[model samples]
Target: MTRHEQQSRLSNVARVDSFSRDTREFVEASMRGDGCLVRVTHASVGSTDIMARRGDYLLHPFPGFVSGYDFIGIVEFIDRPAQSLGLSVGDRVAGVLPGMGAHATRLRVPSSLLVPVPDGLASEDAATLPLDGVTARHALDLLKPSPRALFINGVSGAVGLLAAQLAALDGVRVSGTASPASAALAMQYGAATFDYGDTQWPRQLLDQVGKVDGVIDHTGSRTLNSVVKRNGRIVRTAFGGPVGHQKAATAAGFAKTLVQRFAQPSEVVCSTPMYVAMKRRSYRRDLTKVLELADSGRLKPLDPVVYDVSHYREALDAAGQPASGKKVVLTFGE
Candidate 1:
């Protein structure tokens, strides 16, 4: 569709809040010089540290607490500032920004900040990839699995689930921990599953699966300490508070550190040669594998708790709940 046509179609949809408002606003402000209207394609709410206070920066630096990023829809409405950048309709794009009004009816974004989505992926699924997929890929790269036994503590999460599958492809003996429901889903993704609350769960897992060579601890607890082998490596994603830090230190020793934060897709999507290649080729390969797993009844997209855009607060509330599945996503349509 032409950019004008796309804009006309989007005008009919209702606007809702998204997590990446500031980033989108910043892009939109810049694009206003050229006259572009950006709309969000898809967004997901997962665990983020936007609540923790950093040096002089509120964790959510954006308006409200909208902190998220996703695939965005860009449209050219008139001959304005953004036109000079040469953006066209049907261009697959991705970005990282706050979540709020961005997911609503319309968004204005800078032409320079968007990157093309890989061919063949749906916009909704594409939106989830840049952040969680990249994080999982990068973390697994650090481990460089060569037949090592790996454990993923929260295997049902978007990142954790994808990471477990990726690790299995690398010849790692993947085992995932979760509640019963999530554990079943993890097994479908080719990982051995262990129930999180089994009092003898850790010992049972260790007995059946043996000691793990690496651990991806999304839970941030010391419960799995008994299962890790001596001198084994661990990568943790739950580094939020002082308590989390102390627990990480106690469990993994000084090596317990947060995975290096990756740049927003707006920044790294074009700069990283590997990501560019992955965007062109590997992303499809991996996603196809995920889809195949799903089609063969071996994997499934974690069922999202859906909410209307107007109830963004409720969506966030749902995301915060102790659920075994994935995120609470705000949708414009039922």
Candidate 2:
């Protein structure tokens, strides 16, 4: 096919079968011409993708869906409404979907969900941000009175690293828990790092860094509740547990967790990024701000472990490893 034909072609998606299955080859791509259609260049396989694959994500109850939430791509087609919103054919953009579908070679997404990728940023680097960067920024924004000292649970992870950097840039004293291998990286990003493997780590955090004004808990660990001051806030960046626990996940259970977290007398103001993103409806605004911050060199991008789209299983395996402190990005190369 000619370059023009290829650019205009429909997507070849990474379709997930049932839980814990490898992605099927491609599915037929039909255009409704209702949104901005992009030719995807890079996509990130995050923890949520792993959860969805394990049948752990509540949002992905059914199977046979495409398998990514974040991607960087060039706009191949634009609806009139999307064009009015400032998107155009040939613009390079990055975005997160409310649901799965970004892993495709082509993707149709709402123009409002995407932000223009800065010229200086590479697509691989830009691919790592949309979901995690926005989540970190939004979590920090939820802190009331703004934190003077912040504690991050799981600081070495994707979202945690970004949260640490963003908080540090705001002049907050950041401390966080990480494995021994990743502790230096956490410190390099401006957080005083501790080993989470220690059962007494919370006490260590308090004795060492002192009580924090705010906490961002990505691990869903209740132990983090001890490090925040009485008037401080907490943001729970994720939900569910292991694949076994996720099998038992329910709406009632989710509601109970929310209520229990919120009942902590203002000390724990729980906010999941996906929940907040959907509720606030400010993804485009938040994503644009983070991308601009990255472009301005205020926020450093994580160096991703890149793999071809055909090796998604291997990418997913690498991303699922606990000590893998880098983002796993899949590219659709010629």
User: Among these predicted structures, which one has the highest TM-score?
Assistant: 2
By summed lDDT, which 10 consecutive residues of candidate 2 come out lowest?
264-273
TM-score of predicted structure 1: 0.61
Tell me the tens digit of each residue's lDDT in model 1 across 48-95.
Answer: 522311211223343333245443454534234334544466554555
TM-score of each: 0.61, 0.89
lDDT of 2 by residue, 1-334 (tens): 7986765555677777767555455576654336788888999988778877777767787786777888899987786667666788899999887777888888777787777899898888888888888888878887857799988888888888998888888888898888898898898898898888888888888788888888887555566667777767777666546564663444444554566655552433333435434753566777888898888999988888899987777888888873535788999962
lDDT of model 2 at residue 175?
88
Candidate 1 clash total?
23
Decoy 2 TM-score against native: 0.89
- In model 2, the runs with Cα more than 4 Å from the true position are 1-9, 20-25, 31-33, 247-253, 265-281, 322-324
CA shift at 130, candidate 2, in angstroms? 0.7
